[model samples]
Target chain A: MSLAASPAPAFTLYDYVLSGNCYKIRLAAALLGVPYDSIAVDFYPGFEHRSEAMLALNPAGTLPVMKTADGVVLTETNAMLAWLGLNHDPGGRWYPAADPVRGPRLVEAMSFGAGLTGSVGLARLHAMLDWPVDGAAARRAGKRDLRQLELRLTAMQIDGEDWLAGGTAPSMADLACFPYVALSPDAGLDHDGYPAIRSWLYRVRSLPGFVTMPGIHDLHELR
Target chain B: MSLAASPAPAFTLYDYVLSGNCYKIRLAAALLGVPYDSIAVDFYPGFEHRSEAMLALNPAGTLPVMKTADGVVLTETNAMLAWLGLNHDPGGRWYPAADPVRGPRLVEAMSFGAGLTGSVGLARLHAMLDWPVDGAAARRAGKRDLRQLELRLTAMQIDGEDWLAGGTAPSMADLACFPYVALSPDAGLDHDGYPAIRSWLYRVRSLPGFVTMPGIHDLHELR
Candidate 1:
């Protein structure tokens, strides 16, 4: 028999399964054990994300927008990640900014996610969608972002750490940055030169209850 | 008398006076009473942000990078806003995400900051910095963002909420969105069609410790 309980976790994800932003929410729920409904939008050539129905959900046309059973909708992927980490993670490994020691590093990692990581996603969009863009510059910027992550991860490994936030465990930092970096090859960019990041990608893939999308597989690129 | 026990707040902001991103940090420090040294970076004609010294500080070349006396550095503007909100705001007004009732609204606001408001900033960069870009697309996108904010805030006013996050007071959400919206005209856009956003801008300028950049004044567009 089902026990009488509190309010249900009613989540409806406005998902474009192939979109990394949408995949982020899916992965977050999988890792955190938050269950939800998924509404697949025609994001690619169909461009349903910009349709009137989608605009009613998120006026700016950004996606992975979600509506809680209670009617709270969120559009920014990183913001959604932060919310899941803060509100759901009992182990406190995902949203470690509450920890004084790990806080600053987490902020830095977040900065990287909000700004530098966008380049990689944009480049990927250009490569996959036939979207007109300066592919070379976007790839260059994406490469720079990868190298930056590689440099930091290299140092973390030397110090006996595995996560991006200088903590022993993964935080929203890793989750926010992982998908695009792993899928960078689809944008004609690769991390062959960055061994540390390759290993870190492997580690993310190894997270308990991890999920995957069309472009990237759940496999370790390095040992 | 100076405190003998605890360390002083030694914060230095690597600033570009004309940049709304850098202005964001300056505004935060001012509102919070966090004193900082302003190290003006020759961001414009000189392109010092790409210089070797600047690159050493932030490899991605984004500005408003701040260094605390204890040697902590921050590069992303929104990330820095979140940091200040979490660490320095004992008052709890500026960072309402800590409050459970307001948390979801704050997340929605954070979404706006990370994604939609970026169009205005990018448009501004194109207009003022002699940067070649798709001015039409950027301005179109930026206008759409402004209209979106206006619709929300207008409805909020009818509901008697003045702040972006539906709180009684300004939160990180308000501050994160204010600079770019108020500075929209520099990018060849305006709020003539968005009276609610104009009033909102006025309300922000009217904050107790509010400071002003070069273009936007400390006066209400409405009154």
Candidate 2:
């Protein structure tokens, strides 16, 4: 055997296949080339995430719970993104929490993404899985958030920036917001009026090592 | 004249006096000794935060809008806290996003704090300002969050850690969650049920350079 140090320990992601929040972690790992072992959890009909055992692991009863190699259990999806970026990304551009100008914007965009999970994400769940939520309120809030996102993207496009945090390269901020926005059609909200958001979504999907979920798919060329 | 350079530029904070979210920024600035100009906006009777000018600054029309020295407008409270910690704290401990273990936990705590704003914060608004919201739902949610917070603090105390992120010195995570949790009494959620949370709150209040808002007060020693 060759004399070499052991490979870094892979993260254990307690994930659900249909969860956009779970997809956020998978997409971040793929883009950053970080390795993780995903244990599929039945989130929909099974409601396994809310099971006693899962609640013991994460009191929040949320999907995409990440247990690090060091055994630190992270319940928030954005936290998982931050951990992946800070620990795995060699270029240090994915998180950029150190840069004064970009850091706050990054945090803002990530927070906005989390808000989208409440709005767009909830609406999508109501539509797709027949979840008992105020669908009308969720849709209204989703529309408002989508409009805000479009306006921000339009401003960025006008200012000659490509990503959410206005950095030359995409950061965790982009990944944080991408999944739900891309999956908005499931909520009966389309990108017809959001040209800027459409363009931005395309840009995110075009990134190297980009992955796809059940709702969001890769663009395929016609044979 | 001495050859010293000009002082760092001060940030402009669009604030509301009674807002726990706004107090978060004020408290962070005080703790970090970061100077900033506060522009008071009547969030309650005046509804000044939703005014057109404020909307122009932040489309979200959120209180605690922060205009940085470099002219970047930040609307999220947690973002402002991250900015203050990352840019102002010389010790590098307040926002330790570089440390993989602490970083994810910090993000998790911060997100939890944001959620408390929705639960505890909304409940407080409904109770104090008579905001048109489902007070019962808000209180129920707030109680659940407070219980979860108490459990987390209890676990941290068992681990011999004082702060939310389980760090020796308190990080931004503590500050992010402090305001809403401290102000939960305004929502009729008392600290009598949460001994660990009450102890943690006292510790945060006792920190050097601690500041207070309307509902929260300084522990004055009587003769």
Candidate 3:
């Protein structure tokens, strides 16, 4: 049945199976019960995304572009999350539409997650693959980022809330951060020094419909 | 005296007089006419953000924390903009509540804006002060970022849109990138190569209630 005839727009995700960034959008869609089709982009082979067809979808050359039946394509996980929260979850649990108070905190987390978490993830991925970056440099950068991550995580605990921010329910802040925060060790950074971060990771992972990032190879299995 | 008595909550912004980051928030508040109080933080002599009192306001130790009437402290420029757009401007102008189609494109602009712009800003500041960074190395980085930014601007030109993304009116994407985009000359980068960016800067600079950054000295003017 065409979603156009129905009340909601049909959803489709142009994604790479293992990307944490892609997973963030997919998890949100699944939790919201928004039916979406996933089309794979083989980043390793540089196949689909570089083709002229994919370029037409997103010029930024990134994965996980979400297409809506209304002929709209949503890219960028954080922005997509914001749109989904506003449109789908009217009650505002996934996103607090009314809470201007929590807005900056959530935005900071998402920005930090996208940047710092990304830096750490890259260093870790290079280490896992024994790539070009020297082991010592990778570890040093990982530790530096972890220290900052710990500072933010400690703040989360001091706020005395179960989630990263002070909301009774976890908003995008918690979701934006925890995925990579938990996986930092896999990238060769130690999390033992940050117990609060470890606990927060556990809390997020324990959430219903929580899907782990498929390792670099097992992406197909998860999808 | 309080906004609790009214429908919309009163907005207040805690700012450091000289920080460009803080300027983005103030600019947003001014354009929205949300009526905010500006609380100033002293960034002189040493890093004021590391101070205990400041930490209490924002654990991340960043400025431009917005306190809503209900007393919630919103941190980060992009996040605060998102909240304000959703809460105050239902008109879909400053923050565009309904344009999911352009969501990802806007996020990409903002992300590129935050990271690349911040880096270029720092490089310029360092160059202006005759700081220690290798000139060639820094220029290489600045140029790399400029290439990415140029591509984005070119694409915006193709969309035949004046703003970065979503809605006929400019939103956070434009504001988020405007500060550094306008100041590219300071980084020894040339904007003459990018016609759309030049036009976009004019558009942003002409916004109602637009305020310039307090430079590197008078950041406390808001106080």
Q: lDDT: which candidate is best?
A: 2
C-alpha RMSD by candidate, in order: 3.2, 2.5, 6.1
Give the poorly placed runs of model 3, Cα more than 4 Å off: A1-9, A45-57, A69-71, A86-92, A131-160, A215-223, B1-18, B34-46, B50-75, B83-93, B97-108, B131-160, B214-223
Candidate 2 Cα RMSD (Å): 2.5
> Per-residue lDDT of A105-131 in model 2, one digit per residue for the tens?
898999999999999999999999888
Q: Report the C-alpha displacement of residue B42, candidate 1, in angstroms.
A: 1.6
> What TM-score does candidate 1 reach?
0.89
**lDDT for each candidate structure:** 0.78, 0.89, 0.67
- Residues B52-119 of candidate 1: C-alpha lDDT, one tens digit per residue: 99999987787988776767677767667767776777775676654434655665675576554468
lDDT of candidate 2 at residue B109, scale 0 to 100:
92
DockQ of each: 0.37, 0.80, 0.38
Which pairs of residues have clashing backbones in candidate 3?
A75-B104, A104-B75, B17-B219, B17-B220, B18-B219
TM-score of each: 0.89, 0.95, 0.77
Relative to the real complex, the DockQ score for model 1 comes to: 0.37
lDDT of 2: 0.89
Compute the lDDT of residue B213 as modeled in candidate 3.
Answer: 67
